[model samples]
Target: MKAAVHSRYGPPAVVRVAEVDQPSVGDKDLLVRVHATTVNRTDCAYRAARPFFVRALTGLARPRRAVLGTEYAGVVEAVGGGVTSFSVGDRVFGYNEGAFGTHAEYLAVPHDGPVATMPAGMTFEEAAPGTEGAHYAMAFIRVARVRAGQEVLVYGATGAIGSAAVQFLKHHGATVTAVCGTAQLELVKGLGADRVVDHTAQDFTRDERRYDAVFDAVGMSTFGRCRRLLRRASSGR
Candidate 1:
């Protein structure tokens, strides 16, 4: 098998395609022939070994895991005897920020992990990029306990996570106020946001509408800045 591998942490130049031993299938593993994958921020963060903590996952001296990718879409070439959820020839796509091996010709994943059957009529390229961003977005929405009819504000609404957040919030029946740059205002609106704010032209925190949750997708805002925009709790019932 061949993979985009890096021995040391640095920029894009550090990685190269190299032959590597294919992963052995575990009792619950499925060996996928990767058809599509993505180069995402997580991969770059790990490659650069930025923020220091990333070293804990990769390596302190150098990268322990040479292949760096977290998302993939492909066909199951083989399935472990214990794996019944998926079988050989199943079209699947999924991601694991902790599992960085998808930028390769083959990837082995636990059948019960984040892996799922690809949606009908969707290509591998389309499904491959869906998991990483949507996973983070869904996590935030779940943590916030966002519900139908709730008002939620999303900052950095044009980003991968933010774009998914807008659509997910709308799917949950929330009234979303999305904040993005001027160029992405229409794109965010097309994602089903009830209102869109041009952060480049005006500050979104100054908006009048109180929100049930403020999702800073790009990690640019602090709690102190958006606290005033939150709906205050009151004694009721």
Candidate 2:
């Protein structure tokens, strides 16, 4: 199997495509012939060992794992003895998350992991990135306990997580306000945001409009900066 492998932590130049030994399936694993995968922020973070703190998991001096892709969409080539959920020829899309080995021609994932049958009418490339975006967006939505009819704000609403957050919030019936660059205002609105704020033109925090929850999907804003926008309990005065 050929894979994008990186031995040292640095820039994009550090990674190279090389023929590596294909992974073997475990008792509960499925061997997938990867058709598509994504180069995501997590892959870059591990590649550069950014924030310096991430080294604890990636490695102190070098990456703990050679392969760096976290999400993949492909067809099952083989299934392990205990893997009854999926069989050879089943098309699936999912995230490896901590396992991170999708930047290759093949991947071995536990059948019961995040893997699921690819949705109808979606291509491999389209389905791959959705695993990461949807997973994180769903996590944030659940953590905030978002409810229908509540007001929600999504900052940096154009990137993977941000875009997914906007759609998810709207799907839950939250009135969504999305913040993004001017070029993406219409794009965010197409994702079902009730309002779009051009971050380059105005400061969203100064709008004086409160929201049930504020999600900084891109991590571009801090909680302290968005606190004023969060809904406060009425004093009944």
Candidate 3:
């Protein structure tokens, strides 16, 4: 099998495709023939080893796992004894954080992990990115406990996480206000935000209206600055 292996990573140049031994299937795992995968901020952060915190999950000296990817779409080549949810040739797509080998042609993942059978209507590429945005957006909305009819602000509303957060907040019944550059104001509004703020032209905090929650999707704002624009309680980053 060929894979983008990283023994010690510093940049994308460090990663190279090479022939490696096939991974053995485990008792509670499924061996998947990867059809598609998505490169995301997590992969870049892993490669760069930035912010220091992410290294804890990989390794201190080097990466614990050679391949760096979380979202994958593939077909089950074989299933372990304890697995009954999927069979050989079943199309599936989901996340794998512990065994991050989605960049390769094949990967072994625990059946009971974040992996899920791909929805019938979705394509491999479409399903792959779902894990990251959906998972984080859902978690953020829950943590903030967004209420119906309340004003919710999503900063950096054009990015990966911000795009998902905009919809999630709207789905939760909050009157969403998305903050973005002038070019993305319409795009964010199209994502179901009730109002859009062009951050280039206006400072969001300077606005008199206080929001129930202000999600700084890009981690640009601190807690203190967001507090001035929030209604007593809010969450960011």
Task: Give the number of the best model, judged by TM-score.
Answer: 1
- On residues 133-163, what C-alpha lDDT tens digit does candidate 2 reach at each position? 8889999899888889989888989988889
Each model's lDDT comes to 0.90, 0.89, 0.85
Clashing pairs in 1: none
The CA-based lDDT of model 1 is what?
0.90
Runs in model 3 lying further than 4 Å from the true structure: 233-237
- What 10-residue stretch in candidate 2 is worst by lDDT? 228-237
- Model 3 scores a TM of 0.91
Candidate 3 lDDT, 14-124, residue by residue in tens? 899999888899999999999999888888888778978878878998988888788999899999999998899999998876668898999999998888889898888
Considering only N, C-alpha and C atoms within 3 Å, which residue pairs clash in candidate 2? Answer: none
Against the true structure, whose lDDT is highest? 1
Cα distance off (Å), candidate 1, residue 50: 0.5
Candidate scoring better on lDDT of 1 and 3: 1
Distance from true position, residue 183, model 2, in Å?
Answer: 2.3
Give RMSD to native, each candidate: 2.7, 2.9, 1.9
User: Can you give the lDDT of residue 128 in candidate 1?
Assistant: 97
Models 1 onward score TM values of 0.94, 0.93, 0.91
C-alpha RMSD between model 1 and the true structure? 2.7
